[model samples]
Target: MAVARLGTVVLDCPDPLALAAFYAEIIGGKAEETEEGWVELTGHEGTPLAFQKSPGYVPPRWPAEDGSQQFHLDLTVEDLDAAETRVLALGAKAVDAGDPVRTWRVYTDIAGHPFCLCAC
Candidate 1:
């Protein structure tokens, strides 16, 4: 009864290869540049992700009044602390350091896209 199945989540960034590499590190995928200005990450656990080159890419701002964060990815992890440490070292900037009781923490990728590491 579903209209269609999900194909892939594509993001527009300045450099497709670089963004794909960043996500590949977090999601256990191998990034391959399939075509000019386009890169695909495969062999990952979850849904596939692809990156496309944008000439004048401007990242969205978090906690904006107008909901600048159009969308975000929620990644499930076992240990939030351990995952936080690894993502930080991979050039992800912390957007919100959730409280101790919180189950999720927010961060921005190299391209400034918001994503959450949720404790599972």
Candidate 2:
């Protein structure tokens, strides 16, 4: 039997409350408490962001020799420049780019997760 198909993407964060606010701003919405320090953002409806609390959670030092991350997130936007601006405004730090800042640009979230902003 096929299990019920439900839910979308959910990001893991050490601080749900803080991460919730961060994503809420970038995703353009508010985050609701799902369980104590754990916050959920279903404001996007189809897409749900689940935050798990880990008191000792330490953000990875991405693009550095500190820690190695197993994965990352990528978002597509109509305009790369505009999207970069928006994400930066939401507290995303620009990681690095090749020569030109076109096509795609990598950025690290408040939690130090590397994500890409690509032109669609």
Clashes of each: 0, 0
Q: What lDDT does candidate 1 reach at residue 85?
A: 95
Best-matching candidate per lDDT: 1
| Residue-by-residue lDDT tens digits, candidate 2, 28-85 | 5677886787788766634666777777766656576865666676776787777778
TM agreement with the true structure for every prediction: 0.96, 0.77
Q: Weakest 10 consecutive residues, lDDT, candidate 2?
A: 41-50
Clashing pairs in 2: none
Q: Pick the candidate with the highest TM-score.
A: 1
Instruction: Show pairs that collide, candidate 1.
Output: none
lDDT of 2: 0.74
Off by over 4 Å in 2: 1-8, 64-68
Q: Which regions of candidate 1 deviate over 4 angstroms?
A: none
lDDT of 1: 0.92
